[model samples]
Target chain A: MKTEEMITRLAEGLRPVRRMPSPPVMLALWTLLAASVIGLAALVFGTREGLDRPMTRFDMMHSLAALLTALLAGLAAFELALPDRDRRWAWLPLPAIGLWLGTMGVGCVGELVRLGAEGIRFHVSWPCLQFIIGLGLPMAGLMLWLTRHAAWIRPGPVAGFGALSAAAFASIGLTLVHPTFGPLMVLAWHGVAVLAVTGLAALFGPRLAWRVPA
Target chain B: MSHAQPLCLMLAPGQVARDARDLRWSTLMAAAQEGDGAAYATLLAECLPFLRAICRARLRDAAEAEDAVQDALLTLHRVRHTYDPARPFRPWVAAIAERRALDRLRRRGRQVARETLLDDAAELGAEGEAEERLAACQLREAVGELPQAQRTALQLTKIEQLSLQEASARSGMSIGALKVATHRALHSLRRRLTGGAP
Candidate 1:
């Protein structure tokens, strides 16, 4: 069909639809959902046995960093979903991601320095990975569904950040339930799950979600 | 990959054109959002040339380019509510166009692959049947090009492989007339194939 004819048909069929909420509003909604999921997971799984341990500066820093990372990543994902919006918005989460990595690095180094080679023992928990992924699945699916109408210019970055946002929020829940393991172990397993989710989303998100008219 | 650069540095003269177009579209879109049909029609009408240009640039085939433009327009209509007046309109439109073009390309690729597989499968079957199939196609074309009476007679008797009496009954023609029509069609086909006058 001719372009003019198609355009005419489209205009004739136009029906007013409510505009999507702004990125900030969507991010807020996502955050609320993430918090609810984390809260529910914590309640169901139970908090770690050391509920009474005095919160350390490191612990506070880590929690803050995780929260910031999730919030920033969520915001970036929402912004990236819009096509004509500035691509620079993709960088919004960088600082928070850096802080997250820095906190993990500092925690691992501090652990290594205090506990010499003999005191530090490396361990991997299969259930930790399972819990993180299991909780992350719904959050990831929700993020994808929310952004389905978005015209993704850089689908890879958008999907990567989206996966990161979901995984980070799920990690928060995992931390509350799982017993304290070595900092390095936490970093390794959590980091692996984050990377895996991000990699998978980047690879297949465009094919699955970024469909246009045939 | 090059180090990430600011989107401002990446802006080109084309973006300036986009800015102007987007400004106009945003106004029209805002009006359309408020139930202004004329404004909406004008917006879509104005978008046609731009959509055509983008589709042509992205797609090599002219027909495919036109189809992609239509697809993009339909998609734009479906997602019109997603448009934010604050954002530039061209990139939003371009993103949809590029996506549609890419989808067409991907689908075309898959279709070609499937056809290739089917051709290979056909080749693996009775090799002698290939020549027979080609001859059958040519004969069908030749018979179709004949006059109506001759075509009907040839189709009934030759292609359908029916007996003269059955073909006569089906076509409401006498056996002698059907025979004469079929004979004339074959003679005409032979002359055409042999590069002789009918």
Candidate 2:
């Protein structure tokens, strides 16, 4: 069919679609759902060593950092999903992400000082990795579904941010249950899981999300 | 005598004119998204020429470019809901059109490759008299494996080179029946020869 004819047909058959909620609103909804899912998972699976210690300042600070990262990254992903939006909007989440990494760095340094050079060991916690990733899966699924309507001009970055958002939130849940290992171990394993999710999402997002009929 | 045209004409003036016109497209799109059918039609109509121009610039073949334009229109229709009113319209539409054209280009590339392979196979098939005889013998064996009625019909019509009426009379079957049997026999033999089935 000719382009003009097809356009006419499309316009004639047009139906009003409900306008999508703004990115922030959608991000808020996703954050609420992600928190609930992660909470439920933590309740069911049990934390690494059990929550015997009362909420400490470090714990609260790290959790807040994680929450901020997730929220900011989710907002970035939402903006990136749209076509023709200013690409600069992607940098909005960077400060939060940097702060989160900085906080992790501080914690690592503190641990190193406490343990002394000879005592420091890079421990790999298999259970911790499994828990963060497990919690991330549902969150990632929800985020993908929420953003499926996006124009997806930048699928790789959008998918990466979406996965990072999910993994960041999942890390918060992991911190609640998992025993504190050295900062390096947390960084290594959690970083690996987050990268894995980001890589997979980038690879598969164009195929699975934002499917335009052939 | 007519005045001689300049050899180098600047495109900036025409581009500026087009850009001015395209500025209203976002307004039309926003209105259309609110269920204004006439506005939607106008928006789509306005997009048609621009889309065609983009496709033509990217594609060498006119027919392929037209096909790409249609595909882009279809995709734009499907994804219209994704358009944000606050954003400019041209980039969104252009992105969709460019992606669709790229997809068409890739599919055409693959199709050209497959056609090349088929041409090579045809060349191989035309090798020599010995190979031709061998192929004919294999085809005959494949046809002989068909049901008795189909085999008889194929033999009388194809191998004996008889007319449809003659084959029907010789096989003691109606013409339509003979035609159906011959078609089935040929289909079965082709499948077998092509290694698709026994």
Candidate DockQ values, in order, are 0.24, 0.21
Worst 10 residues of 2 chain B by lDDT: B1-10
Best by DockQ: 1
Count the clashes in each prediction. 0, 0
Clashing pairs in 1: none
Give the top-scoring candidate (TM-score). Answer: 1
Residue A64, candidate 1: C-alpha displacement in angstroms: 2.3
- Would you estimate the TM-scores of all the predictions? 0.69, 0.68
